[model samples]
Target chain A: MENDKQKFRLLDTLYILMMIVPIVFGIVLKILTTPQSEGIAISGAKIFFTINLPIQNLPITESQIHSWLVMIAITGLCLFLTHGLKEKADTKRQHIAEWIVENAQKLVIDNMGDYFSGFAPFIAAILSLSAFSSLLALFGLYAPTSDVNVTAGWAILVFFLITYYKMKCGPVVYAKSFGEPVPFLAPLNIISEFATPVSMAFRHYGNVLSGSVISVLLAVGLQGLSSMVLGKLPGFLGEFPLFQIGIPAVLSIYFDVFSGVLQAYIFAMLTMLYVAGAFPADEYFRRKAKKSTI
Target chain B: MLELAIGIILGSCALGAGVAMIAGIGPGIGEGNAVAKACEAIGRQPECKGSVTTTMLMGCAVAETTGLYALVIAILLIFVAPGRLVDILMETIK
Candidate 1:
């Protein structure tokens, strides 16, 4: 207990130092550096750095770096939560872990039925990754989901899962399934199948991108307004954007917090629904029985 | 001549973007109707609030797709179309 207390005190001091050092450095740097002429430059994710490949240059973007950071943070969180686990819940981390897992399992079971309880972890992974990626915008980082390619990649994976599950009934049935109701509708059905992933990708990407775009626009407008109104004031207060402080936070609550988490939840729910629906009623039973027999 | 052409192109792009945003009206109305119905359903049977809210949210999100599509088009017009149009015009002029 004595050793643990000493270790925790050391960690506390380290944490405080880590938090304060960069902030102090940033303030000093800001004061020393010349003020930028440009008011606010709003644009898409910048290529942070590039790697020279054999065929082409691989550009690592702001979104990509932020995503890596988010992944690392999540991994660290998981490690922290699962460390020193016992048979019984002796710690708060263990209790929290159990709660998260149990809730995820319950969500899958409720939405996609008991057979899809296996998908709980997958759903949880998507939920966490998507939500965390979006939430990064709150910290003034470019969100991965704001990049169409990232969301497209996830939507494509979900699309493949949906198609794969649908094909489990048999190739013949899968092919014929498109021609249902009438032969004339086959092309439409095929187009709709393709549209599923496209819409999913665009929906998620557009939401996050629009949020960031609007936020930037609002900040720029507010800054301009503030400058117009208070540019004559003495000292740093004149240059500083007073109006840009609290109002943008209100919009950020909706765009960054609510919309981000809501979209993540909706994406997960849609994935579950589409994948579960892909299985024919008879196929679901057959698969269940097969698993039981095995 | 080049300046006039550039102005014309940019003005058209802005106009197109504004026109595309009219698509938002449909989604706004549709979502309002959905919420109203959901509210009635909840009022009738408050016990099923969980499922009702879930279904309403799903429907609203799906309904918002058209508006989002329009938003994407508008964004493309505002940000992308002008540059491409100017480039093509430049090439043609050259």
Candidate 2:
């Protein structure tokens, strides 16, 4: 009992120290480093490759690097977790793996119906990738979703799937569907069809980019406020950014954690719904009938 | 003349962004109404909460597309448009 109490106390101290050390380090770093006047630059990928022959520069951006990191981390985790799987699950890792797979299956089944069960892997991958990329911003990495290109890539894939499924119904039916209810609205129908991917990509990119912009502004603003408050103090003490720590963390919770998860979920949910909507109308009714009968 | 042009450009962009944000009011009211109805439904039948929430979120997402359109416009006006306008003014002055 005493040993357990000692262990708890040690952990509590370690946690407190862990929290405080970062703030102290950040404050010291702030004092040491000159702050830039301009906020974070909104720019494209930095070029990493140079060709000697034609003098071509191949650029790799922060988004690509961070996304690659996320992919590697996720792949490593999955491999590590599922390394030793037995018929009878014993370890915590196996249990977690099973739970994740089961929930993903359930999500796909619930949203897209049993007829689209094959889409489970794709949906799971998108959900995990989106969530991880968004959460990457919390660690001060450039979130891949902040780039419109990344989101557009995902949206284009979804667009292709939606179009392909609609085309599968019949080329005549597909072409004629655009003119249905009123022939005059055909142009509008076609525009709206194209608008799907654009809107999806823009929605996600805008949310994440706005969140990043706001947080950067907040941090800079906080630093300014801190310097003003601390500037009154004598000598070296005036240089410290006292207000930089703890305060912005409260806002970060909402901007980073909450919004990131929500946007990721919304993006995945929209993708699933758009794809499911492309399935034949009769299949939906049939599924509904089956569920009702069961 | 240059100062006036720059001022006008910045002012117009700000005004446009503000106007774009006005689209938020629609989604605000819509999502509120949706959640309120979902809550009422859940109150009437607690067992249907899962389906009710999912449907509510889906409806809310559809409703939010208009707001997102406004946001995209606002972002363009605030970030991209200003820079291009400034560049154009510089070229004109040159």
TM-score of each: 0.88, 0.81
Docking band of candidate 1: high
Candidate 1 lDDT over A1-294, as tens digits, reads 999888866765654554445334433533444246755666677675799999999898867766666766666577667756799898898999999999999989988987677999899999999998998777666688998888899999999999898888779879988999898899999999999999999999888888888988999899899999999999997998789889999999999999999999999999999999887768657877999999
Q: Give DockQ for candidates 1 onward, in order.
A: 0.80, 0.53
Q: In model 1, which residue pairs have backbone atoms overlapping below 3 Å? A: none
Please give the lDDT score for candidate 2. 0.80
Off by over 4 Å in 2: A1-58, A281-294
Clashing pairs in 2: none
Estimate, for each residue in B1-94, the C-alpha lDDT of model 2 and write its tens digit. 8899999999999999999999999999999999999999999999999899978977887787788789889988988899899999999889
- Give the whole-model CA lDDT for all candidates, comma-separated: 0.86, 0.80
Q: Ignoring the other chain, what TM-score does chain B have in each prediction?
A: 0.99, 0.93
Interface-residue RMSD per candidate? 0.7, 1.7
lDDT of model number 1:
0.86
